[model samples]
Target: MPEPHLLAADTDRAAVVTRLDESLADGRLTLAEYEDRSARAHAARTYGELADLTADLPLPARREPARREPARSPVASALHGGAWHGAWGHDLRAAWTGWVTTAVIVVGIWLVTVLGSGDLQYPWPVWVIGPWGVVLLARTIGERRSQDTDRQQLPA
Candidate 1:
């Protein structure tokens, strides 16, 4: 550790002030005591002076590292849990349901036009379906690859 007589940086002063704030919040220090200590903390010129401000206070509790979870796209969350968590298949099914529903609606419209005109209309629904299907297929492929990668990462 560096010598306590060494000059303190703004960060050192700020750390001491933060502890003073916490002490005040916890009712360990009255407002007058906090104001005095905080003013002294900002004016402190050495690590030793800063340390004196909190020397009698208990150490702050250690904070746990936050847990990591898989990142999900907005579309994926809507499918998996944003609408309702754990009641459906993972994001995959929800993603496809949208494309399938739209495809059915567009095809039904095309069929109606063909019947009314008594002639084959150009298969127009393919315009709506094809690109969307390709996108969903690509997303499915990526999702599968990620699942495979996750499975491999697990210990045998």
Candidate 2:
């Protein structure tokens, strides 16, 4: 008959494998580390050995503790100090494209309006069309860039 502890350990192995898998998915453990640790966990024949594998992981840290302290980066400090802060992380090319498109649409609408009626009036088409198109294009570009970065990081 199998020892009760051995049976319990075998059952607990599934939980350990689950935890290891989650860590691997979240990038906390590299692929190699995950495979090695998973193999060790699977080979463990006793509850004590399984427990030992998880002994080093701390309980999750509280988010409140992190939020209580103000961020100390120079950029953050400058923002807090009332310095003129431009939009951080904005792609200038994206912004320029958006502005240019907006301008073009506005001009096109103005021309249409002038040809239809000889009056300077706000163009609704410019407001409706330009911003969304530019935003979509920028998001597509950003997604591709992020994918490229991920591909580069993967072990060749």
TM-score of each: 0.43, 0.34
lDDT tens digits, residue span 54-86, model 2: 666544435464233444677765677422222
Cα lDDT of candidate 2 equals: 0.63
- lDDT score for residue 111 of model 1: 98
lDDT of 1 at 84: 26
Q: In candidate 1, which residue pairs clash?
A: none
Error of 2 at 34 (Å): 0.9
lDDT per residue, candidate 1, 54-133, as tens digits? 98999999879866557677788788634223222255564565577688899999999999999998998999999989
Which candidate wins on TM-score? 1
Q: Please report how far candidate 1 places residue 131 from its true position, in Å.
A: 0.5
What's the residue-level lDDT of 40 in candidate 2?
90
Alpha-carbon lDDT, every model: 0.78, 0.63
Tell me each candidate's RMSD, in Å, in order: 21.5, 18.5
Query: Model 2 — TM-score against the truth?
Result: 0.34
